[model samples]
Target: MIRRTTAAKGLALAAVLSLGLAACSSDGGEAGGGETTDTNGNEETSAEPLTIGTILPVTGTLAFLGPPEIAGVGLAVEHINEAGGVLGNEVSVEWGDSGDTTDYSVANSTATDLINKGVSAVIGAASSGVSLAVVDTFAEAGVMQISPANTATDLSGYGPFFARTAPPDTVQGAALGSLILDGGHCRVGFLVQNEAYGTGLRDNVQQAVEAGGCEVVYGGTGGGQEFAPGETNFGAQVTDLLAQEPDAISIIAFEETVAIVNELVAQGWDFNGTTYFCDGNLSNYGDDFDPGTLEGVQGTLPGAQADEAFREELNTWYTENEGGELADYSYAAESYDATILAALAAVRGGATDGQTIADNIRAVSGSEGGTEVSTFEEGVAALEAGEEIRYVGQSGIGPLNEDNDPSSAFIGIYTYGADNTYTYERQIEGSI
Candidate 1:
């Protein structure tokens, strides 16, 4: 669910949301320990020590999302180790900071470092831009990589070794369009950033809305900014929206949705009794945007209260291990899944080496060996059985399609309740 805010006049924010949102290849035989012999005629163990690499933006703009993602990785690691390190050998992680920069040289250097250190696979670069920059390097090295939260459609076709937890923005946008129509909105406008993420999301929404029998009246565009964080000076865009007089205006931008909402309210622009927001603007964005301002907005996401059990568990874990707050972000869960998925792939491949693990990543995400498994434990068991394992994770239940893209369930629909609090509305009907 998302919050609704008033816009000034022009409702022109349907382009910026796509900005932030990977790759690799290898084919040779699997490397590392093959087989071993033991006394007493016991079967030899193929257990070999392995290390995995992780790159997260622990500082700068996206730092807030890093901690939870890292925590998820840690939890997955603990679970894997407790069950006996993959293949009977200890597994370890090597972490690096992406440092949040436009030039991904830092991220690329970090990936090279991990490759040199001999990690079996890599698990991050939370931001899609960073992931794209370093993906080729990892691919060249034959190291498999899986990002927890990148939704851009372009990345899916980048390489064989790439996979992600977030469904592409095209699917998400389409889902949101259907949501807007089902919610009784006839005319939908959009506010977006002028980046890949935003354009991608806007395109999806446009297509979905058209398919859903809704009309697109206005679409706004803006450049990404760090200062606003969830607020935007969308006066120009709001003015345009007012002119279009759309029934609902979907802000497909980031960090500016709230500002657009608040400005509209201040200007006395009613939603004209329509709702606003898309997945890009679904976050709470902290205290910067008043909760009361979003009393009636809505959005489509990959999770929702339907998974209340997991939500409660996540909250409990944060309270116990963190400072009592789940970092205000959604990507954390996906990041954790990536780490776990990579680890499981390493185990199935039977070697910690990059080529071997990269070749076998499909075992965890593909259909041949992966079926009827949705939890981390289930994936591990399937791997142990020497059968291809289908790992349907906490993120969703869909299997990874041939493009290395997992079909995702749009289960998160939210609404703003009284007192600036948020509540889960209802889950969406199907997978994207």
Candidate 2:
């Protein structure tokens, strides 16, 4: 009645040992004693607590995304450590900043420092530019990195080391294009941020629309000057965009999309003209903005909340552990799933070295041995049995291609009612 697999037992034992010590400890001063071999083929002892790093943009344009992403990662880590630490070592987490500037250089520096500190994996860089800056660093170091939110198309091919739980915005952009076509709009204007996230999404959507024989009326860049989340008063840009009077408009900034909506409302722009927002704008909808602002708006999202299967547990877990805050936005669930997938990969990889972990990531996310691993226990068993394992997680079934992009669960549709409630509309299963 109380049997445990070797990996599980190792993790449990490690957790006990870790709990006996401090919940947080740095390198060279931790509790456990089992040594794992490094890439150099030399035997190295596992630290008393295994450490992972999270790079979050806690105070910038993308700041709104950072907390939920961190919360998800933290929850996954907590769940893992509570069940059993990895390989019988308590899991510890370290923090680094992505800064508020949306600068990849800042993300790069922080990621580099984390690498030097010897973390097995990293769990963030929600901004696409930041992720791009550090992808090569993590890849070369053989460190496994899982992104919760970076949806830029450039990242799919960044490296073997870079993988994300969220489907890239290209998929969402294309779906939005289709949604526009379905809603009987032919020409539209776009006001996009000039960052990797905004540009990539806008480009994809524009390409999709062009391919569908539609025309782009006008496109301008925003978010390049004075980029800040929770900022409103886009009167200048709205005046310019309204001058074009296109059939519709796409707002592609992260949180600044709200500014665009507010600007439209202030000028009494036609909200009934099918203004479609991307996933980036999902979390920012609230009563702070006018209720009529997003009444007829449609949102294009990658993967939706599994509300029926996951909401109750999600709400309970978040409230108990995270002060009643739950991630109900894009990539929030995916981020949680990514953390679990990484931990499971570590267990299946049989060693904690970053290269081994990276290799194990593919095994779990790709189709090489999918049937063998469907749950945490199954993955551990497969590792013990020495069988290759593939972990298909709850973040909408992953089987990546050579580019490390998910094949299942393409872009989907969501509609925002005047009550500021988002409803999942439909799922698009093919490439746009």
Candidate 3:
């Protein structure tokens, strides 16, 4: 069975009955409930309200991703509340900043504050390295940590309390590797970040590319050629990589991509379909480069492209609530799905605690056969009708597997135009 435990359902019923009795007798309108075990095996009240905290990149290297991700979470919260919330109480969210890996202080302190605030789950730290820094803190506190955009392979099965809506690097890596090979590039060079996310993804891409009869001429995994996170200057790295005279080069870093691109251009490297990008470094370079600077370059990002209706909704919601327009939609769908899945798990397990969510998330994600649902309200209605519901949300990810990663997902391929902005070319589906 996908559900790890059967005890939560009975406990949830008991808590509901207890609350009912308390509501009938109490003058202050406070409800009573039974205690349950958290992920850390500590006793906690089952009647606690569900409060999710976000540790997303509000500042630092990945700041460009903040707007859409935050909007996705906010929209999910709005939809959940409109559906009468989980366990008969409205869901609440706390926001915090998860700066990039360059400064662990931001993520650590944010994780500390969110945990101290009694958040049942945390949905953030988009960068895998940032998550690696704070995941243990949340895990030890019995708080579920679900990332919307973490793809490092090492994070799979990191802990029972750790889950992510994003598929692992295995899926994206294979897609990107196949794309590069299909371009007829047999010699590839990498400019990977020397961190968990970068190295892990680089390894997967290397394997896929090599399997397709290609050679990594430079900067493959463990070649001691990766640049440090937050590296400002890449002249040396770019020069060394280009010295190999490879037919193709892949840049696997975050904000440092701008510097790398500048160095590549300065060294007379062509971006005309020869350069590839992964999710981390793929962004609108219109502001950073002149027209046609990145023309024909291609990149891959995980998650299905948001449809026009969803994009408009996200834009409207963000503009109204956040006073900003949604720019990048990279992990927005994944973020929305992550939030909804966590909420449904809470409902299914009948508790607003992390352990219960961990126990039931997979089942709600359709690891076991169930009625398909697309919205929070539909899912709630199905669960209320005594049916197990499989939530197929905006991201279009497959069911959560035993490793807590999506079993299958879509990888979006994009190509840059003359304006240095990327357009979705197509999607490749992969199973992990």
Q: Against the unseen true structure, what C-alpha lDDT does each candidate score?
A: 0.62, 0.66, 0.84
**Tens-place lDDT digits, model 2, residues 1-432:** 011112213223443342221112222323654765432233554533456787766545666566566556665666666666677776666666675334456677777888887887888777787777777888787777888777898887677687777777767777888888888888777877666787888888888788889877766333243233345667876777678778888877776776677678778877664688876776546686767667778877776455554555555554654344554645656777777777766665556667666676666765575454545656655665556666765566567666666765656677777776677877766542
**lDDT for each residue of candidate 1 in 1-432, tens digit (9 for 90 to 100):** 001122222312331122111111111112345463221123555656666677775444455556556556655665666666666655676665564444466687778877887776777766666787888888888888787766777787678778776677766776677778877887777766655566667777778888777677777323332122333477776776778878787776554565776777776665423665655456665465554566666776654332556555555555554444663446656766677677776666665566656665555765564456766567767655656777766665366666666665455677754344355677653554
Q: Model 3: per-residue lDDT, tens digit, 1-432?
A: 000011223223543342211101001111344454332234444656688888887667787777788778878887887777777667777777787889899789889988887789989879999999999999999999999999999999999999999999999999999999999999999999899999999999999999998899999977999888999998888888888989999999999999888989899999998999999988887878978989999999999999999998888877776555776788999999999999988877778889988998999999986999999999877876778878999998999999999999999999999999999999988999
Clash number for model 1?
Answer: 49
Which pairs clash (backbone N, Cα, C closer than 3 Å) in model 2? 10-88, 11-85, 11-88, 14-88, 31-48, 32-48, 35-45, 60-100
Best by lDDT: 3
Please identify which of the two predictions, 1 or 3, would achieve the higher lDDT against the true structure.
Answer: 3
Candidate 1 TM-score, true structure as reference: 0.78
TM-scores, one per candidate: 0.78, 0.82, 0.90
Off by over 4 Å in 2: 1-30, 33-49, 100-109, 137-142, 220-233
Instruction: For model 2, give the 10-residue run with minimal summed lDDT.
Output: 1-10
